[model samples]
Target: MRKKGAYQQYKDVQIKTANQGKLLLMLYQGCIKFLGLAIKCINDKDFEGANNYLQRARKVINELMSSLNMQQGGEIAENLAMLYEYMNHQLIQANIHKDTEKIKFVKKLLLQLLEAWQEIINGSNTEENIDTNLSINI
Candidate 1:
């Protein structure tokens, strides 16, 4: 096996230091990356490579689903779980049929989810900035 490169080491440290919300965003980004690769592999007539990428994407979706806090997150968690399930089903069908169209559709769905997560991250950062700027005027 090859030794870890500098970039890989840096990414590891970044992930280790990231908060939960950032970690969640990373997972979504991973899903989008894998799905995009899977689509490209299909376009290249590399069904095997596509299958591997799709399976990796499915694993990320499963992780996201399993990490949901149903007890605390309630309806939002449940909704996300359902969406993840649908994506997994779509991925399985794409893998079995080696369909580029299905892969594109799933990629689109994942991209939408990633965008929403990014917006949420940005919104929280804005709120944090506002909180830090406020002074307790007695």
Candidate 2:
């Protein structure tokens, strides 16, 4: 097998070493990226490319939903699971119809969630009571 590229190796290390909070942020960023790419593909009339990107975004959302710690997260996890399901459905419709607007809406929601996650992670890091390494499982 061919050796991994430098960037690939770096990403591997990053993922391996990241705390649960960081991993969650990475998932959100990745989903937003895929959604943006899908929008661009739709604008360029590349339905196949759009479908591929939307599928990738859906996978990320699924991963996020699966990672949630429902027992500990309580109502928050339940709400997030519902939202993720909605986003996945929107992505499916967007892929079928080649709808840039729907993709844009999903991207907007992801961005908002990313910002909130970032703040939560940052705030938690600043507090000594919170363990950065603790698995929130999100």
Candidate 3:
């Protein structure tokens, strides 16, 4: 196997060191980035590229959904899981149809979630508070 590049190694270390809240934030950001790329590809009439990016975003949503702790999170986790499912469906439709509007809708939802998470993580002075804010399992 080829050796990892400096940036890849750095990213690995960063992920290993990050807190749960930070990891969640990263996932949201990554999904948003992929969706943005998909939008650009759609605008350029690159259906293959858009499909690839949409698939990546869907995977991130899957990860987020899997991380949710229904037992501990109650109604909130259930709602989030449903929302994630809807987002994934939207992504699939966007991919199949090369629909930039659907991608934008999903990206908007992710941005809103990301902003809420940032507020929760930033406002917390204690790890316990962070844990409380996060409906998903660490």
lDDT top scorer: 3
Over 1-138, each residue of candidate 1 has an lDDT whose tens digit, in order, gives 999999999999999997666777788889889988998998899988999999999999998888776765667777888988998999999999988788788778878877876666667765444222221110
User: Worst 10-residue stretch by lDDT in candidate 1?
Assistant: 129-138
> How well is each residue in 96-116 modelled by candidate 3, as lDDT tens digits?
888789889999999999999
Considering lDDT, which of the candidate structures 2 and 3 is the better prediction for this target? 3
Q: Which window of ten consecutive residues has the lowest lDDT sum in model 3?
A: 129-138
Native RMSD of candidate 1 (Å): 6.7
> Candidate 3: which stretches are off by over 4 Å?
none
Model 1 ranges with Cα > 4 A deviation: 125-138
Model 2 lDDT, residue 126, Cα: 43
- Please list all clashing residue pairs in model 3, or write none if there are none: none
lDDT at 87 for candidate 1? Answer: 87
Judged by TM-score relative to the true structure, which candidate is superior, 2 or 3? 3
Let me know the TM-score candidate 1 reaches against the reference structure. Answer: 0.86
